[model samples]
Target chain A: MTTLYHQPLDTASRCVRLTLSEYGISTHLEVEKLWERRRAFLLLNPAASVPVLKTDDDLVLVGAGPISAYLSESREDRGAPLMPVDLAARAEVRRLMDWALVLMEHDVTGVLTHEKALKRSIPADHGGGAPDTAAMRISRDNLTWHLDYLDHLLSTRDWLAGERISLADLAFAAAVSSLDYLGEIAWAERSACKLWYARVKSRPSFTPLLEERVSGVIPPAHYDDPDF
Target chain B: MTTLYHQPLDTASRCVRLTLSEYGISTHLEVEKLWERRRAFLLLNPAASVPVLKTDDDLVLVGAGPISAYLSESREDRGAPLMPVDLAARAEVRRLMDWALVLMEHDVTGVLTHEKALKRSIPADHGGGAPDTAAMRISRDNLTWHLDYLDHLLSTRDWLAGERISLADLAFAAAVSSLDYLGEIAWAERSACKLWYARVKSRPSFTPLLEERVSGVIPPAHYDDPDF
Candidate 1:
């Protein structure tokens, strides 16, 4: 079995976890206090991000994109393929994944994480300080634009992205779930996106993530509720 | 022939250009003033980002990740394989590509582009004003950490990532080139990275990119010099 080092509330980590579970590859989940910045953890990922997977062969795969790609290739027998085999479909899937990672994750989830999580978690040496007000305001305003874009996409397709469920869907779901935990999602204004998120939140693989409890922080009451 | 909507100074756009050229896939280059936000361009990429490729079949691939993935899958022969066939290698490559897109590009190249290009090119309706000084400062300070990390990585590996040259290398090269155009790279402090970049900048596929001149902005005198 492989070992996955991650924080409970990390959207990127949870994204990798869901992809692994979908592939039926069980990993030893090691909850890492990223703020602690242990030397051992630094060796695993110099960028100091997670989730980092240590394979059975001792190969360390860092970052969500690589880990998902590795598991999708390693366990091809179980579940629907995380990435499409067709050229055009695969490009679309990759495009959506990039959007989730670069656009949504950066613009929305990043704000919440920095404002709510990092501000509380950083060590003394790590410049534990107040979040940038301007950046947070920009992030908040940008959320409306992003959610509207999501609504437009979901209106035309059943999923946030492609016709079939993909790693992209899972990635976006993880980000949304994290934001929901922080009560940052404007659910009322994004009905379609919220409904789409409800379906993703109800998946069996998502159960473990929903049940995840971050230390000193309580998730929203509706976070675990599939009907939300 | 496919049409590539691009701006020459844009690294993400250049990454797609290199991949297309390497695959011997001829494309009609349409230089887009990305800041202009023309209706047709916005229709193609809602995010208003560049490197959008319109295929011969009329399908549009948005972003560098999708465009590179599409070209890799669409072109069976020509140049070295951009992505590996082996699953582990492929995952490693993808992870590095993600690092460039999400980490380096967002933090480093994005800052430079906004400060050097976007701020100057800001159209009237977009609330054209001076650049965000605080954001630019943070971005500038963040580059040293990233450059040092890249220097450490390249100390052992010939490429920015895995063994053979992959999309990761191209993506990193593209980002670095964009910054270099703005004369932002501290080359003396990043000797190894500079050496690695020299090899990438010298490639035939990269030469055309070096020769490209943005309308208002001029690159460093040594920008086109492979030895720089």
Candidate 2:
């Protein structure tokens, strides 16, 4: 009986949810509106972020990195490890995952989310004013650049890091999926990335993410379509 | 022998150097001026980041996250693991490391480095312009806030994550050390943080980082002093 505190459209939370599914771990989901900064949630994560997990033993874990690493260290009955057994391959998995965590999420998904979703929800006095169009444009260009890089990688590798699905795939897929939900990805422009994403979409783990809905925001028509 | 591509005051590179030293691995150091964006360096890391490790076996590991993970998965002869063998403890270590990487580095060190060092060294055309005073002020406040959090953690725990010295310590100490080199940390204001840092600074693995010299920028007089 693990409970995961998350927000539906939060990219990090989505990544954790996907990792949990891949590991075949069932968790009770609780939505946390981080902006509200609830006292109990703040105690769970002083950083005031989402995706805090409480294990069956009641050990609390905060942040996507901790949750991802914990889930990857599998026991015999849980599932096969999401991390590669080989050392070098494992490094690649971590490298790709880090890239997604720092570069993709921070630069791209964060930009899009702030502009597309968060701006409309929170009040202006709390630093949530009108969407910064200039920032969004730059992020869009950056997102395209990242898509080119992903396409280059997908041309050679079946998964983001290597031949098999790992946390890297989960991370990259989660990042792109968040922007896709906002209708920001130019899928037709990058055939390799589209093909790779289509494969990710078919996975049962990703199904939960597609079904998620924020309070007042509706996803684009192609948001949940694997064939799109 | 391994080769590490790094910049002298780069926090991520310093973290990797500390990790490698902790594991007793020797490597040739190559200072990469990231702003220069060398073609070969870009080949090694498409992300154009430093602390790219080329192992004796020719496996290239980029970023502190991957490099730390690789170093921690040590064989008996290499060294004892810097990560705790227990699953929950390992998660705690990783949680703190990620907090350092994402919160401390992104918010504080990046701002200070850009303002105090890299801005003067790199050209305006490459996006290195005059330091924004408002941004620097905000970052300074953020740095103080983080130092307070670090002090709060160290008040009860022997190390940042736990009693044992782990990669969490290395990651956080590296971040603060870089900022300390720039004379940004107010040691007098936070006694506990200063005490905890003194312990980290005295470690043999931290020796090389203290001795490093960037080409143009000079660190403060007390930068290398373990007793400071």
Which candidate wins on DockQ? 2
Q: Best TM-score goes to which candidate?
A: 2
Worst 10-residue stretch by lDDT in candidate 2 chain A? A73-82
* Tens digit per residue, CA lDDT, model 1, B1-228: 799998776778878888887777889999887777889999998888888999898999999878887777666555348787787788777777777766877777777787677667677577456777888788889888888888888988988657788888888888888888888887888889989999999988888888987767888898999997
In candidate 2, residue A54 scores what lDDT? 94
lDDT value, residue B161 of candidate 2: 80
iRMSD computed for candidate 2: 1.2
- How good is chain A of candidate 1, measured by TM-score? 0.91
Q: In candidate 1, list every pair of residues with a backbone clash.
A: none
Model 2 regions more than 4 Å off: A76-79, B76-79
Q: Which lDDT tens digits does candidate 1 get at residues A147-193?
A: 78878989999875577788878988888888788778878788899
Model 2 CAPRI rating: high
lDDT of 2 by residue, B158-194 (tens): 8988888888998899899989888898777889988
Q: Model 1: share of native contacts present? A: 0.85
Model 2, range A9-63, lDDT digits (tens) per residue? 6778888999898778899999887778889888888888878999999889988
Clashing pairs in model 2? none
